[model samples]
Target: MDIRQLSYFVAVYEQGSVSAAARLCCVAQPSLSAALRQLEQELGVTLFARLPKGVTPTEDGEKLYGHAGRLLSQLQSLKASFSQPVARVKFRLGLIRALGVERMSQLLREFSNNVQGLELHLVEPDEHCDARIITPQLLKAGEAFQPFWHDSYLLAMPPGTPLSLQAEVHLADFEQLPLIKRTPCDAWNTLYPELVRRGIKADVRADIQTIEYALGLVSAGVGCALVPNFDTLLQRQDIVLRPIVQLKLERQLGLAYRKNQTSASLTVLRQLCQPVP
Candidate 1:
């Protein structure tokens, strides 16, 4: 119900006894037990099983333990930041899963370091964030969108594969090869429809969820995969990336943020992420 109650709940859950938790928290045992009882009453859930010697968390208590721990950690961080002379600005950033977090880690870390009093929080694509790095499909109506990067889809194959040596690969060239499928991809969703429109059949070998898994399959020479022209993916010497000659598909990435939102950090992020003309 409150910070104190949550703290007490966590203590008893960890210590497994009211007396032990009270000693650890420097509080009276009766007060600690009363706090836990009050918390359970407020939440309308039996949080623990009373034992003769100690206590054990019930199902609901186990679930709340994780949440309470994280909340306490965030509260501690908030208090510590407030104690400092410089005010800390919490900045949320939303990233599309397909854009690849590993590729952006270094650049983001550099940005975080360069900007003083800035605390970056990574969140889901649709959540509230100061700025969002998202694809065109995810771009909302009123948010300010700035083109950040232009990425093309490339055919990735093992280095020694027959198609790897081709200067250009076509739909017809794919008939004999087994294609590794990546689901929930904007590129695939767009490409497949066009392929169907053109009456080209894709000989799908497997349907995978993540790019890493798809790349793993390609690396093991299980089958060829279609992936973005990311530097991280392209830099692999074990795989060959060839331009799709017949289908010149590419995605335009942009930063989307509310028009009313403006800050020093956002300005610096815009400068860093905006494409150079």
Candidate 2:
């Protein structure tokens, strides 16, 4: 429930014996055992399974072990940060929209699960921020960009479309193909001009901004759409995403932060960045 209780719990978990953990913590055996009981009651989780010899941590205890260690470490670090009572650290993190829902959710779950005593502010890319997950172009002067992952742009077509039969879509294949035009996309900017230069008149079906909605149109048999080959889209049974042959288009995304400023919160923010599964 508190720092002392967590310390005792960690000791008991690691030592695997109540009497030994109590001795290590310099507390009486009954008092340390009582503290563990109170912590378990407060958390509503059975932290340890008692045996004749020693204790074994339950699945719930194993899950809480890492959080307890980090929280204790975080508290220890705060001792050098200030001489008084510590308050929650607020972190402002900006993110661009339409990074696949599944990937973004996984990244955020890692951020939320690992750390305590921190508050998060999620906002748009251009807003005021401590750090932002975005592409390099959004980097301002004196800001540093650390590249993380790249997403490929592919043509999304409704199920059973004749073009979906092709192994890889070509530029000429887009000629007169009913299309869902996703605007403000860099890949579209490059691919559309070439389509225009070749005198390929794309059958423009719809003009939309967000890729999430564009995928829906593709599923409904409205038309083919050009979208980043996000896992959520590529794996969907209702739509097919095919990379354009000989035209390599990818969007690189990463973290951007002030050049010379590194706070504890920024370090924690950077640690949360993970590879897409």
Candidate 3:
């Protein structure tokens, strides 16, 4: 089976409809169907089970799908590598709000200047939930992609807050004060239950969306809000970031791309962000 056939198959599996996959793949339905058939014939196994609503991968198809995804990622990476020289490496980066936009851009600029032939394409996570919500989609699309950094979460408070200088603060201490929080929809949702377990109910004084807004609330003394330590924007003189001594609130940041397609430039980028051993 050709790469085109595998591409069509994977698209069908992901989209759940041949017609939808056809639209996404920019190929006619008939051609996509024909390719699927050709692929099944070559493998001598039934890859999908036709149903009234859509196609589902058969057991054998499921097994092949995993391998097919990795193979395609490698092929795509190879194509990208061949098209660009070492001095012109193209990189796609996804950043969550934990890493402020200004800091991310600055880091990318420095990274590009340091690495020869490096181009950076940066995408911010949507609604701060992209790391958990969208990362699986990226992984399924290509297993070769991996994240490079893991940023720990920290609590942000107005400069004079009593807890500002402490290395960490427990949920109980936060409950004693007013809180400004990202809505339950934010990625920090994963940490909410732990707060509840500590017998602390978030006394949310304001519900904010973006990190800038949350920091703004903290600066205004609206309440303390949890933020990632990597956010340089919140590290201003007016604001104080203190590690959560008891609650290790944290998330990871990293590079992801087709695994086999990892380039020398990408390696350098990864090395720069590598955590201390």
User: Which runs of model 1 end up more than 4 angstroms from their true locations?
Assistant: 1-85, 101-103
Over 4 Å off in model 3, which ranges?
1-91, 101-103, 114-119, 124-141, 145-147, 162-167, 183-187, 231-235, 262-273
lDDT of candidate 2 over 1-277, digit per residue (tens): 8999998998787666788779868899999999999999999999987776678788899998899989998987787478655467787889986677645755664575455666788998889988888877678898888777788888889879899899899888988899998877768888888888889999999999998789899999999988886643443567887889867778888888999987876776677664445
Give the per-residue lDDT digits (tens) of candidate 1, residues 88-146: 88899998767764437545855776787777899988888888998777878778889
lDDT of 2: 0.81
Which pairs clash in model 2? none
Output the worst ten-in-a-row residue range by lDDT, candidate 3.
Answer: 127-136
RMSD each, Å: 15.7, 12.6, 18.1
* CA lDDT scores, all candidates in order: 0.81, 0.81, 0.67
Q: What is the TM-score of each predicted model, taking all chains together?
A: 0.65, 0.66, 0.52
TM-score of 2: 0.66
